[model samples]
Target chain A: MNTELKLQALLDGALDAREIREIEAILAQDIQSAALMQELKWMKAAVAGNEAEVKLPETREFYWSKIERGIAAEAKQAAAAPAERAWWLRFIYPATGLAAMVAVMFVVSGGRTTDGADTESVPEDVNAISFRSEAEAMSVVYVADENGTFNPVGQETKNEPEADK
Target chain B: MPQPPDFTTTLDVQLVAFSQAGDMIAFEELVARHRDKIYARAFSMMRNEEDAIDLSQEAWVKAWQRLKQFQGDSSFATWMTRIVINLCLDQLRRQKRTRAESIEQLDEELGGVERQMPVVASNPTEGLERAELRKRIDKAMTQLSYEHRTVLILHEFEEMEYKQIAKVMNCSIGTVMSRLFYARRRLASLLQSLKKEQQS
Candidate 1:
């Protein structure tokens, strides 16, 4: 710190013994520093205990009324917070269940079929073609022997009459 | 409901305890006690009656909401003062952003302006009555920038140490000291000028 601020610290009683001695020594030697220190002391003394008395203009009841209203508003807001959160939770619970159901269905079906359309697959060594329809819930399979003659081996239809089961 | 307990005779600490227990009557008593000091602190910082009143009211509401957190480290009045001071600082910062600072104010904030000011050799406040001294000080305070005025109010009026002022003002200790030095010097100069104006 410079001499001026050191003088200030001295006036505020902020300086330790060593710093006080140092500032005192400076004060004895420098007229300007001493003068500045004196001015600071005067200002401090004048300002202390001299704050202008100010009163809240409103009556006690009037002022307290506003504070009461503010507290009520804040309390209301705090209470509403949990209900606001529950509103979001209402959507979240069903959305979570729907997601879990979709996950399970994907696992059970092995994979998803596009557009619920019929799908046909032929295995490499079986020499057979299989047809499946997710929408109709039906399956048909045709097998071919060494002569390449195709014959129906299995057929299942969800819409078939019970006598045809 | 049964008649509410009499709070007129209750001490501040008891009132605070009751307030903590969700007693609005006790909290109201606390407000009735220290409302002036709190409003004064805000006005001294904000320099506007409307803002001071509004902020002081806001401080009370905040105090009530946060009463559970009051640990009684400081006197209830002091704690309330701190709340109001913080609120005023926030309001001042917001106001500062929307306004332009004068060149003199900028110089004051940047430091070294007090050096150019010549020292007032005679004590400007010497032989003044208590009320007159207060009036002069208040007038002189109005002449300072908010930063300078705030530092003075914090250091001198609030009786806060340099470190405490730094913490409250959200600045470095060096900045606090520098601002304080400038404020004191400028205040001396202004008081001297007021004295001369009166003499003439």
Candidate 2:
């Protein structure tokens, strides 16, 4: 803090005893500092109890009526808050449930699947083709030799059609 | 069919108690008693009758809503004054954002303008009447930027300490001291000018 602010703190009784002694010493030695301090005192005193008195221009009933209406409006708003939340919550809960159900179905379905579709990969020396179906729960792999004739190498079926069981 | 309590003679504490118990009449009495002082504080800070009245009324409504939070740590009037002060500060901050500041006001906020001002050798308020002093102070306060004027009002008229003013104004204590110094110096300068005008 500067000397001027120190003088202000001194006037406001904000400084400790040591700082007070220091500021007082400065004030005693410096005429300008002392004059500034006096001016600060005058300003403080002039403003302290001299606040311009202002009255609420409205009558008591008139003023309190608006306050009364305000309190009522606030109370009404407070009371309506929970209902407002519940109104949104009504949609939120069902929407959340629907979203969770859709996510679960997506997870169980293992994304997109093709039924009766075959995928083939041909190597430099051999040609092999593979078939899988999540809908039918089955997989088949076929390999072809240099003669261009294909033969099944492996087959697996988790579920097969039942005639009368 | 029960008669309402006579709130006119009730003490503020008792009235506060009644108000907390959901008695609007008691709260109304409290408002009637302290409304002027609260409005006066708002006016001093806002410097407009319309804004002061609206803000004071808002403060009262807020006080009622937050009555349960009132623990009676300070007098009801002081507590009410603080609510109004905070409201005024909010309003002032909003107003400050919308308006552009002049270079002089910006410089004042940046600090150290007071150091350049020459000290007024004579006391300007020495022989002034109380009402006239108040009038002069109010007029001078209108000339200051909101920050400087607020610091003066909080420290001097509100009797707040530098720390308290800092807390209320949401600034550092160092800033509080600096602004206060500037405010007092500038106030002294303005009062001197007013005195000179009167003399001339």
Q: Distance (Å) between predicted and true CA of A1, model 2?
A: 1.6
In candidate 2, list every pair of residues with a backbone clash. Answer: none
Q: Pairing residues by index, what is the TM-score of model 1?
A: 0.79
Residue-wise lDDT of candidate 2 within A25-137, one digit each (tens)? Answer: 99999998988888888888888878877777999999999999999999999999998899889899999999999999888978855464554345666487766666665
Please identify model 2 stretches exceeding 4 Å from their true place: A91-165, B1-3
Recovered fraction of real interface contacts per model = 0.92, 0.95
B99-141: candidate 1 lDDT, tens digit per residue: 9988998898889999999989999988999889889999899
How many residue pairs clash per model? Answer: 0, 0
lDDT of 1 by residue, A30-118 (tens): 88887788888888888888999887888999999999999999999999999999989999999999999999999998986567588
| Tens digits of per-residue lDDT for model 2, B1-200 | 99877878889999999999998899999999999999999998999999999999999999999999999999999999999999999999999999998999999989878889998998998888888998898899999988899998888887888889999999999998998888888999999999999999
- B29, model 2: CA deviation in Å? 0.8
